[model samples]
Target: MKTLYRYISLELVKTATTAFFLFLFVILINRASQIAETILGQGVSFLDFFSILLKMLPAFFGIVIPIALIISITMVFLSMESNNEITALKSCGVSIKQISVPVIILGVVASAISFYSTMYLAPKSNVEVKRDIERLVKKKLTMSITPKNFSSNFPGIIFYVEKIFPQKGIIEDFMVSIQKKDKLITIFGKEGNLRTENDTVFLDILNGSAQILNWKKPKDFQFLTFKNYTVELFKFSSEERFNARKYQTLSQLLKEKNVESQTEILKRLCLSLSPLIVGILIFSIAVSLPRGAFGTGISLTLLTIVIYYVLYTFSKRLAFGLKLPEIALLPDILFGALSGLLYYLSIKEKLKIHTGARW
Candidate 1:
């Protein structure tokens, strides 16, 4: 019994490790591709790109590890069932519950790791990534602004770029709009060039026009056309709202006590427990069905993972939109209860099989 238990434990762990790496690899590639377009286009140093990648890693693991665990355990057990190892073990007096504890323990460990990542590492990493981005935007102005979209990343200002030329190092159709507390400024240019001094970004525009308006007096507006224009693109400020709720630690979040912080806390809790809950659901299905039939387990596993993530996304939207943190736990609670019911029925089926064979 000891040997059998050890073998099962090792197999599950080994399989889970493989699944974890595979899924992590896929996620890394996908995530890299998504951000690469925006960040890499700037022609930044490779070290900066690598730093960004590392900072973003912990933020995703909390969500992906659970799916990896679900897939790993389900795949291994279903393979065993397909090969009749489970049937043989049963014939030799091994109970499903007895053999399954190892996988469940592994799932628990995965759950704990997920919880830690979501509650601690994720928030820290998010803050680090935000800081990294803020620093980068300040350090490299031309590379930081992605052309063709409105970006509010700059402190207290929003701007849009129409076209960017890396080879010629020119910006075409340059337009900037800035609104300060008491003043509003708008500038338009046919073309512009960027200059960096120490850590500041300066935009040098030729054949441009500027309009100034006093916000307090709407009727006071002045427009001027110029042959050459110069302006500071972005200045780094510690007062920027980079301390977002998502990037705050648990203590910080609790102290905020706002709907946003409450939403994040519940979302983390739901995400942390999702693995164990989904694992149970997968186990309940894998145990009762014949594994080799149409790869139903794989299909269901994928479906469950998709549905699980969708639930979180929707829950997050609802929680923030409706100002309700309780809604975040809806999916977790519903799936957990369903998993229990399925597991109960599966155990009953196994018992019936055992009894019928004796008769």
Candidate 2:
């Protein structure tokens, strides 16, 4: 029994580790690709981009590891059963429950890790990711504003850029429009430039024309050919509301004491539960097959994982849109439960075949 336990435990660990790495690799590649365009186009440093990517992996790994563990456990048992190792154990009087305790222990440990990661680390990292993006935008915005393009529309002002260069701090073909007390003022310049000293940014224009339109008065226009024009600029702060998925902490989701928040909480919980459920499903399907079906086991495991993730995605949208109860995650929970139950049934079927045989 000791030998059997050791062998089974070792095999489970090995299979789990392999599956984890495989999942991690696929996730990292997909994630890195999605962000690559922004990093290169916005002139974010390679080191900064890489740092953000590295921080992102913990969240990815947290989600992936659970599913990997489930599939690995299934594969290990399947391999053993196909090779008559499970039969040998049963012949020696080992019960199914005896074999299940270790898997349950593994599940408990995985669940704890998932809770810790999603509850604290992921939220903190998500905030950091946002901050990094803001920094990248701020750094690039000054450079991105160029000649003949509408940069951004502020409350009462519109800015147009002509050309910009980093080393020279030069801007050309500049225009600014401001509305003051119902008076519309338009400024056009031959050349313009930007400079930042401390927290203040200055838009400097040279040799520009100014036109003012007042509601109650005749149009007043002034054309000035000057050495320089300087305007003290204030940056736009981001005040966008965060969705539950974007930057929410797990505790906030869990303890919110509201129906919508509770629904979101359940959805996140589903994300956490996914690995175990998916793993069990994969394992049961894998083990029921004969030895020659190793390739099939791998293929099925991948297919099932993809399908589950798709279900997870669609379910979250539905849950949020419908303001579903916390129990809305029941469908996913059922799917997972069915996998385990089916695995049990498959075991019974195999046992029945053995007992009825007259070979």
lDDT of 1 at 41: 62
lDDT of 2: 0.67
* Alpha-carbon runs more than 4 Å astray in model 1: 144-173, 190-201, 215-220, 225-229, 239-241, 350-359
Error of 1 at 36 (Å): 2.2
Candidate 2 per-residue lDDT, tens place, 235-345, comes to 545464456554678766766677677776676677766655665556556545655555666677777767777777777777767777655576467777787686587
Model 2 steric clash total: 10
Give the per-residue Cα lDDT of candidate 1 at 106. 77
Which residue pairs overlap in candidate 1's backbone? none
Q: Top model by TM-score, which number?
A: 1
Looking at model 2, report the run of 10 residues with the lowest lDDT sum.
350-359
- Candidate 2: list runs displaced more than 4 Å: 40-44, 95-97, 140-202, 206-227, 231-245, 350-359
Per-residue error at 180 for model 2, in Å? 10
What does candidate 1's lDDT look like per residue over 30-132, in tens digits? 8789767766767566788789888888988897788878887788777887788888988998877787687678778988999889888988898888888
- Give TM-scores for every candidate, taking all chains together and pairing residue i with residue i: 0.85, 0.74
